[model samples]
Target chain A: MITKNRKITFILSLISAIIGIMFAIQLKSNMNPVPNESRSIAELRSSLQKELEKHKGLLADISKYNLLFYQYESSLNEGDSVSVMKEELARAKRMAGMVGLEGEGTVVRIQDAVIPEPPPLSDLEEHSYIPNAVIDEDLRWLSNILFANGAKAISINGHRIIATTAIRNVGEDIQIDTKTIRPPYEIKALGDPDVLISGLKLEGAEENLKLAGKQLIIEKHDKLLIPAYTDARVIRFMKPVKTKGES
Target chain B: MANRKFYLYLTLVTISTGFLIAASIESTKARNTERQNEKQFQQETQLNERILAEKKENHQLEVQLLELQRKVSQVEEALAQRQSEAAEILSELEAARMMAGVVPVSGPGVIVTMQDSEQAAASADVTKYIVHEQDVRLMVNELRAAGAEAISINGQRLVSNSEIRCVGPTIIVNGVKSAAPFVITAIGDPATMVGGLHLPGGVMNMLQDYVKIDIQEKEHVEIPAYVGDGKMDSSAS
Candidate 1:
């Protein structure tokens, strides 16, 4: 009779434990219905658009400084000090893509490939299907290829390719820095045109582009003009490290 | 005696049952109250919306700040024009040049020469033995932290936006091609820069196992100015 009673106590404890676990789960769900699902798709889209507009205004302001710096430079007279400054500024501007570059190189333009839409109610049709787009990763690889193959300066749709420049996708748009550029990406490189053209063909670049559903158009320009970066960021946070014994 | 023990067990069980029932009843009541508070749930959603809106407003203010700074520069230009302070302008321009890394610089610092390990050639995976762009970037960062006035890898000077990246087997510095045995030159106080590079678990120690690293303290190291197109033609735009 004692053994039967002990078994009944064990069964009761197991049933109570299961009930407690279910209660805890229900409490957790009540606290957090869905994590990070607060913002709707429409809200995110508008926020990104607002950010792009603000960036444009900032760029316009920086261009004014660029104009003043030039005027000051031209005002200086012919002297050792003045000449050195001019030479240095000119060199710095060229490297920083503040100046236009014209050289014999290749221009690669990539566009999204057109694919036929599947029939309605077909098994192949997917509800979450994303259309073919020339992604940032594709452009990054293409630019890296050109840079590696002796391209001195490069510009994509007037945006100068620089070290700090980031290629990122916001929703569906490909953003370089703050500029959102559309399809038919034009990449102009300033280097040996023959070498640049040949380099793209190397390492199955065409095959990779095809797999990504992109069409490539390569043209060798004797004088391809690549524009400078209009917006130069002012370094406010990073000051030069001061050495010892300096005021 | 057996009857007394049974009665004690029965009393304990009855108390536990009463406690469990009371706790369960309280939990259900609390849950019902939470479900009824629709205002709290709406506030949470509204709070998230406010955060995104605030971010947009912040960017708008930044744009206004940039515009004001641009106007201030315009005023400065006008004032300078009236004063005709050529000497002052020339000095400012000179300082700009130095910061721009367009002129050759020389100072006391350390030279780091890194080469692929000889045994790496025989290893199945040779990638581990070769020096990478990150390795160069780490050394450059350490030197800068130690108050390096100037830095260069091979002949390529490290600039503000300069990228040191690897493409295939070669590492590219400032758009210049480079192979193994990268000789990095830094201009700063000889003692401090050396200490920064050779610190415990520093870049030198970390890369020593994969690549042969040699450090030399020099009285003077000259870094040549960038020879590429350094001038911008603003008129073209």
Candidate 2:
């Protein structure tokens, strides 16, 4: 009888221990569940959607180019290739920023902030003052913001921004395409004025400029003219990549 | 009496064990139903596979489009050879397209690769060490100042209106989002571009502390054409 009792006790203890371990595991897993996989799955779904849209766009581009090629071939057959070529050249020139363009857009003016008069000599030590000045980086950031907001064409002062245009500081002066520009810098961009204005505001352009001791003044214009890139562009390094059939 | 007590203890322990098992089963079932099940895992895998397939197809279509564009160019060249007037116009158009970044270009230039500093992942102040949109813009400006004729970042060709800006942690170039490391290829004098980047207080010097940058001069660098919308509808000249 004693031996039987001992066997039962041992079996019960083992069963109880297993239950305790299982209960601990269940409690632990419930408390600290695995990282949410659903969130990542949602991300994957959105990315997939973006890729599908891009695929559609690429398909559209291919069709458009195919149509253009067909037109060229037809023009060749009709002996009207010159006119068609001229039209194509004109379009290329316009897209190359080789000609002036005018359209409805927005005008942004950046000016140096006016400093108030100093209170007194004794109060100067406690007052930390930042100078009000417009820098090259400010213009670069503003132009980038404008372009991202769908600005088709942009010009600062009178210098038109092109593919190779560089805005940088040459010593103390801000140069746009090798021309020194001064404040208050007047920036004209051709696009939807409301959208451009909202872009600037959304980027907190005013607040940023204010922190730098400059003022941002934006105006919507019904007609804004952006000049052509005047700097002489010499292409020396780049050559067109030859196609497989071309010699 | 002892036997009776033993039976009572055994009954209590068995009941508790049964209760623990039931609770565990209940929690496990709840979790499985709440978060992820086998079906959800399978669905996620399927979605991932679809995305990968779509990306592959898009790449193939882009190549096909490039070929078609080249055919057009070949035809134009053949026509230009037949007529002198057309020849002049064709040459001008070629130059304009090159300047507008509408045509693929190949030449000797420098490629600059930039990435977030490795220490940034461990550092508390991560923003200072990571690459930003301003850093990229500054790099491009420097390259252009050094006379980079053609430039592209991660295959996105730079055009007159190309915008490089930061949206969250990714950099958007020509309306497409990409993350570091950004590889900027410039077709120009490699030595001059390298010098420009290394100038004291230049973009490289300023950003060197925050990011990892490597500049390589290569004899051949091929830049693709701008695939974005080339038409300027707002510009009515």
Candidate 3:
């Protein structure tokens, strides 16, 4: 026969097991709500639009400056000169080799920059951003020289560098799915040859390029004419930061 | 003694069964409560997840909207830029046209001849130093600046609405084919316009800057009437 005390212990144990199971079920049900990740994405988009509008206005102003310059130039009679003078256009349109005499200006070449392997601590959590600080400094250095030398505009491949445009750090070996460009970058600049060349040399860009495993070449000739892009982009939208965990 | 033991055993058996039943009842209630609570919690969690997903989707749409807004804004900017530039050029042309006193004969304006340098064409890779689009834009800009009342290429008219574009080495004037010694004509003060283009650092300078480029500015230059339909279609937006 079972003892009274033993029987009571068995009953208590069975009840305890059932209660434990119920507690477990409650815990599982609690895990349903995760809202922060998705909401953050929406918030980001609203902010970026406001930023783009501001920059767009600035670009419009710069274009106005160019238009005013254009209008003022057409009124000159034969043999008249404008504020900006061209040494070559003064004569018949010059062809290659005709203007091939060695000029004293800088030479610009464009190429690709290789991406280094990421560090061990790059657990994908710290947010690996493009090296904006370093890239901006290099670009700023280039800009200072071009500005000092009176460059009206500069083109990389066919892309024009306008007054309001910026040289952004796209990524290492991936700019809009194209290979990342770095050294020996080919840049076509419009301005006074004497002024532009001297300006590039002023900021010690040559030495800086050497240190950074890159190069800068600026070629100045009356024959250096680049076509204007028919479809120039006025602005691009900024992306919002990704939400954590839920994404 | 046997009877007493049997009675004791029966009482014990009854108490144990009653306790077991009570425990079973409590367990059943607790399990039902737990399951209901779990279902409620799951529904709440699912709702939360849905809300989060919706929020994320909304955010993505917003970003796309922002991008579209940026693109449209840029288009508007380009349109304004072209208009102002064209206007300025038109005003200059009008003034030059008044000074030159040329009448509308239902024909294009004075034609200025642009050609590859007669001497430079013999060189290797002649195109390397050919006239560039910018050069044309500069010259055209100067023409407008100089008051070109009406302008055209070959036979196309230069209205407040017209385009002068270059394709590779060839020039595109109002969808018409043209090449070196691009025949650009302007109506207005023919003499004044020619003089204005010849101005140092004007269209002449821009053209000269190109490879093997030559520009001929003339007055009273009779430009042919547009033969081909100058169908002007522009997507300003």
Candidate 4:
């Protein structure tokens, strides 16, 4: 009986030791703190901000080169041959709308005409919701008129209206060379302000402008800044036929 | 009495041994699972490091590109400043040809072809079925809006003062009269130009209502310059 008691006590002591070791390990693991979620998120945000700053720096460098190139091209040179070349270059630049010109010009602002609410009268029934509001054709007509009246350079909303520049409606937006501009459209013509203003008064122009349901605001500015064309002018598809002894 | 005491001790010994075996097995399984978690954590950390390295490399390459661009600009400026009379004249002549749309240019662009609907002959209003000058004008307008560097309609280069007007059954583009189907070749970024035309309710949608229009993105497109008379007379003062 004494031997049996000794055996049972030994087994009980062994089991208790095993239980104690397991509990100790679990307690140690639980005591360690969990990772801080907020800290990790803050780290991620900081990295993203750093990346964006780097990207901006690169873009600024590119623009700096662009400005320098423009300045170099516009600088005048000496000598007879160089002068003639310069003159031709200047002419080409103007014709291509690559140079910004400032002159006494007229600014025509065209905005959507606000239709008044119907007064609930029988005569006013047809007047509600007048759908005409400064469509693409109005601007085209005005631009054509300006050109015909000897406007040297014309720009609409900073987009130099060159021969290749097209004013078209893309889903309620007027896009000029991948740039979408909104009303009120400011059309600037670099010419005699008086002449341009008078040109707008030509036959069928004023009538056409009024019928388009646009609020027309015309004024004269002594110095209007028309921006240069900032897109590629590379030509392909039609080569100049070689004249006699041209090569 | 002695036998009963022996049996009780034996039962206690067996129960304790069972408890020891169970605890060891549970601990080993927990350790194996924890090892897998650690392996996953290490892989995640390696991926993060790779991402950081790649980003740093990208930044370095971008800086190099910027530096090279500045160098090119500087060189160009110097060259322009020191160019001889003949060189300047030649360059200006080339520039003139480019602006006049008389020089061939090759670049990435999109090609658009418009064909009259074959089924339109049976329809009452065949005018709407055929590609009109208005349709060509709208397409060219959209292409220009999409930043097309150069554009041509059925091999006629559109330069300054080029007109697209309908004369009876045919369309006159740049004084070169052509009937449907008009092929418009433009040189620019293929994707942006195509995207601009294909935008919902855009030029493609509007033109597709009348004629069958097909657009394709080409990696390289060649546009011939204006082959007509080089009339620089339209220079507006």
Which candidate should be chosen as best, given DockQ against the real structure?
A: 2
Best by TM-score: 2
Task: Name the weakest run of 10 consecutive residues (lDDT summed) in model 2 chain A.
Answer: A238-247
Model 1: CA > 4 A from native? A1-84, A114-132, A237-247, B1-170, B175-237
Measured with C-alpha atoms, the lDDT of residue A31 in candidate 2 is 76
Q: Pick the candidate with the highest lDDT.
A: 2
Q: Across all candidates, what is each one's fraction of true contacts kept?
A: 0.04, 0.56, 0.00, 0.13
What TM-score does structure 1 among the candidates reach? 0.42
Better of 3 and 4 by TM-score: 4
Query: In what order do the candidates fall by lDDT, top score first?
Result: 2, 4, 1, 3
After superposition, the stretches of candidate 4 with alpha carbons farther than 4 Å from their true spots are A1-81, A100-120, A136-153, A163-173, A178-182, A186-212, A215-227, A230-247, B1-97, B216-221, B227-237
| Cα lDDT tens digits for candidate 1, A1-247 | 9898777666665565556555555665676654445555454455455444434433543454455456545555444334443554565566555667776778898877665774576554654344467776667667767766767777888798753455655668988777899888998887778887888898467778877677788998887788777775543212222122111
Report the lDDT of model 1 for residue A149: 70
* Per-residue accuracy of model 4 over B137-181 as CA lDDT, tens digit each: 778877877777678888777765465666576666644566677
| Residue A168 lDDT (model 4) | 75
TM-score of each: 0.42, 0.85, 0.26, 0.51
DockQ for all candidate structures vs. native: 0.03, 0.46, 0.02, 0.06
Error of 3 at A234 (Å): 34
Cα RMSDs, all models: 25.1, 4.7, 24.4, 24.4
Error of 1 at B132 (Å): 9.1
What's the CA error at residue A160 for candidate 3, in Å?
22
Per-residue lDDT of candidate 2, residues A115-229 (tens digit): 6885687776676557656778889999999999999889999889998999998888899878998777999998989999999999999999988878888999998889988
List iRMS (one decimal) for every candidate.
18.7, 4.4, 21.7, 19.3
Candidate 1, residue A27: lDDT: 62
